[model samples]
Target: MKVRHYILLVLVLFTGTLFAADIRFTASVSKTEVGTGEPFEITFSVNANIERFGAPAFNGFQVVSGPNQSSSMTSINGNTSMSMSLSYDLVGVKEGEYTIGPATIVAGGKTYHSNAVKIKVVKGRAVQQNTQSPSAGGNAPAVSSAPSADLSKSLFIKAVASKTNVYQGEQITVSYKLYTSVNLVDNALDKLPDFNGFWSQEIKNNSQRVDWTIENYKGVSYHVATLKQIILFPERSGNLVLDPLSMTFLVRRAVASNDIFDQMFGGGSYQDEKYKASSAPVTIHVKPLPENGKPADFQGAVGTFAIQTAVDKSSLKANEALNYTVKVTGAGNLKLLNAPKMNFPEGMEKYDPKVTDNILESEKGVTGSREYKFLLIPRKEGNYTIAPMKFSYFNPATQRYMSLSSEPYTIKVAKGDPGTNVTAFSGANEQEANLLKKDIAGIKTGAPDLYKDEEAFYGSVGYWLLILIGPLAFIGARLFRKQQAENNKDQVKLKWKNANKIAAKHLAIAGKQLQAGDKKAFYEAVYKGLYGYLSDKLNISAADLNQQNIAEQLQLRQVDAVLISRLTDTLNLCEMARYAPVTGISEQEVFDKARSIINDIETHA
Candidate 1:
């Protein structure tokens, strides 16, 4: 009876597990084809309770009203189940084919992404762009045909640069501020400016929360949030255009009373409308640094700085360690400054300097100091003098180049132990032998030992061990051959076993291509590596495999959703880079990401 009970309990648990794994979270649209200005419904529903849900960005459509949460519970024959859904009413705003990306949800302590939905928008009847409607005609106020103009003026992002005209390598500040008069229901950043042709340093606040304040722009009061603050230094001289920052905002707009109760109470209702706000592109006119007064040794530093040098000790024994430091203190692109040149006397070994920065950024500008420490070793005893260090920078504030000279350092080196070995500097090959004195003794002077065998080779221990190796080798070879034969019997299993090797071979090719500066071949090899890995590991044919089935197969194997997503993204990037123009992600980066995804899949799945 106990055995039967255990068996029954095990069966019940197994069935419950299967049922739990059957949770279906899917996205469906009312119409796959529609006309421009026609509104449609898209619903994301799941059979099980979810913890978090994220709606996909509606790129080519305007959300009239969205994400209405509805839940229902049912019980039949003592079995209860619950389901929830979030639906959005979106209208096509552009006449083109578009795809709505996947929506994500967290359930059962795991996240899942729904399949993408595609929509085709064609020309439709002209719709009036009215912003208001009479409430007496209907319970709800009709949505305007055009929401961009209405929401753009209320909620938008403004990219503000401190100064547009400046010399190359001059420091400037650019801030992307979100100004809003309407209540923001939700928001997400779409794209950040690439900021090409410039070196950018973003100012990060201590807190993750946005600091909101009331600000009046163009005589209109609005709540503003500084989204991103960046400090940029132009790398070249041209009319460089600062790309726009794009974001999507769900705004709550005051609409006519949508309910009979609200209409009777003389109250207004609000509708959540989705609108995308892209900051206007700002052009910065960068001027070349003046060449007339520029110093010959200037290292492209455009800032005001003060240099100070110090030596740890002016006198030291030969082969002793010495610490020399150079510090530059002041503000204006201190982070961009290069290492100052040092002129140490002969017979001393100098090393690369260790750089340290103490920088602070504020509204006024960047202000801080940078320090470089150099390590030196004197090998011979003599009186040596280090030339006075010189650092020149083009100060945009003064509109001229200036140079600073540090006091010279004179050192007296006393001889120590002759056994100490100091490597020669530069190409002094003849002096190298004298400088390199090893502490250990030279090669053995006596002749090598050679003796006749004391015992017969037939009965020695080595002879017995060697005799045993022949039988062991034969047995090992036999077993390996048999195992290979069995593996060959099942081609599928062989492919599965060799999946990792095949991917690695392709990755090796991709690495070679990356070093050779072959973008096309590099991307192709990376794409093949990832896809071939998936094909062999998942038993899916490469030609027939698409993103949808790949995702499904990975999920069936119980791979983590996040890892699957990463694999998909890498595959997409590799494929896209093969044909289209992919920026911000380099070929090496794509290769690394692909290799990492394959490794992770092997590790986890």
Candidate 2:
């Protein structure tokens, strides 16, 4: 009788499980055809109750409008179920027919997929204009149609340089302006262009809406916008290319209608307009300075500038050194532009110069000066002559190159003082240093013999006793904690307690590599995706580590051997590829291998 009762209970539970799994879910898109830069909506809905829902990854399209969610519960004849829906306003990049989605979600221990919907996005209908004037109210009078103010017709970017022609190493102020005559709702800026081969400075970044004013551009008046401005210093003397900066903005187009109300609201229709405006990649005719006229010490710098020299102190003791400041201040790419070459006097020790810049922007463009501070020390006591300095740059406004020079200064020497110089200056305070050194040497150094009378038992029972007790004590404490947790009956609390241990143990190996600058090791551990699987995975600091630290951190994370080895190899290759002596086919092969290892570890681990 008891056996039959157990069998009956088992059968009832199996039936319940099957009944719970019977819930079904389905979702599909309305249409798939889309025009370039047109907004469309995609919906994901479920037909049955779900414990949780999620959206699938949408790779190609951007969610411009929404991920609006809705939930509803309906009851019919005392039977009830709930459904959830999610929708997004998406935009395609180009005109095409696309398989919108089979969006998926996992809930109630089962996976559900939405229907795969196809969409065709074709070119939009032609816009028609109404020629009736507003004054022709009662008796409509025909008026010849003319294009109104449409900002969409002329949206562009312009690169305005202070001067297109310059000598080598001269500074050029480049400003990017966005001009549009179209009505706009919103616009998104794309990725910025790379200013390669030029030492550039971001002097101004406009983050506020520019107050627009009417300006006559080439005999036509239009509303103009100033987007970005920068100061560029030409590093290499050649025809360097400046790439185009592109952006996408919502362009508002008015709908032409005979009805005044329709023209007001439906004219509010908007479309995404991509603006790829840039000035022609400028070709500056860079002129090289004449060989005979150029100064032998000239370091290829050409610009208009002036210089001044000053000394912090003219009189100093024998061992003491004084500061000599040679300042060159003027306007001409002062940020990108380098100052004249400074020559250190004979027998003077100098460290790296501490550079400081204070630049501001104006209608004249970015103007600033760089100050180089040098820390100098004199070798011996003597008078020194600091030579006069010179600087040169081409003035874009004047269309000619200019130069600046500073006057020379002299220094006097006397007896040394400790405060004036760190090295070479010896005073009466030197005796205090000797007394402290003697005191430090007069101390005992040896391990203490605290256990002299205790019995030393090795390779005996006592050694084994200690080794066994250590693990036993740990096990006892763990078991006690487990028992306490079970009594409390808190699963989430228990998960939190053990999470760090498991995470740290797994991340130990990787953590070591991360600290040691091992890029391969760092990325490999990050790719492991263990953090998503095991709660106790180590918390690895992924910042500021070089390739060597990356590998060592992996070991520190205590990652498994197979993963660690692969990580180390990948890290080493990344480092080598970045700083390798030879750059060719082998470098590409190594990079490919590293990427493969990263993906393999991510998926398999």
lDDT of 2 by residue, 53-164 (tens): 5666665565543355544333322233455667775555545566655777655436777677776767753211221111111122222222333333465667778777
How well does each candidate superpose onto the true structure, as a TM-score? 0.51, 0.43
Per-residue alpha-carbon lDDT of candidate 1 for residues 1-605, written as tens digits (9 for 90 to 100): 57679999999999899766678889999899988767688989998766568899999886654455544333322233556778886777778899999999876457889989999999984433322111111122222222546676777789999999999989999999878766665666677886766766666443323567779999977777777788888766778788999987666666776688888987776677788889999999999888897776676778898999999999988988788899999878776666675668877877766677798977656788989888788888998898888989988888999999999989888986775656444434334555455436688887766667656787889989999999999999999999989879987788889999999999998898789886766777787788788888888874346676799988988999999989877876675454334577777778778888888998876
| lDDT minimum window of 10 residues, candidate 2 | 128-137
Instruction: Provide the lDDT at 344 for model 2.
Output: 65
State how far residue 221 of model 1 sits from its true place (Å). 1.5
lDDT score, candidate 2:
0.53
Cα lDDT of all candidates, in order? Answer: 0.76, 0.53
TM-score of 1: 0.51
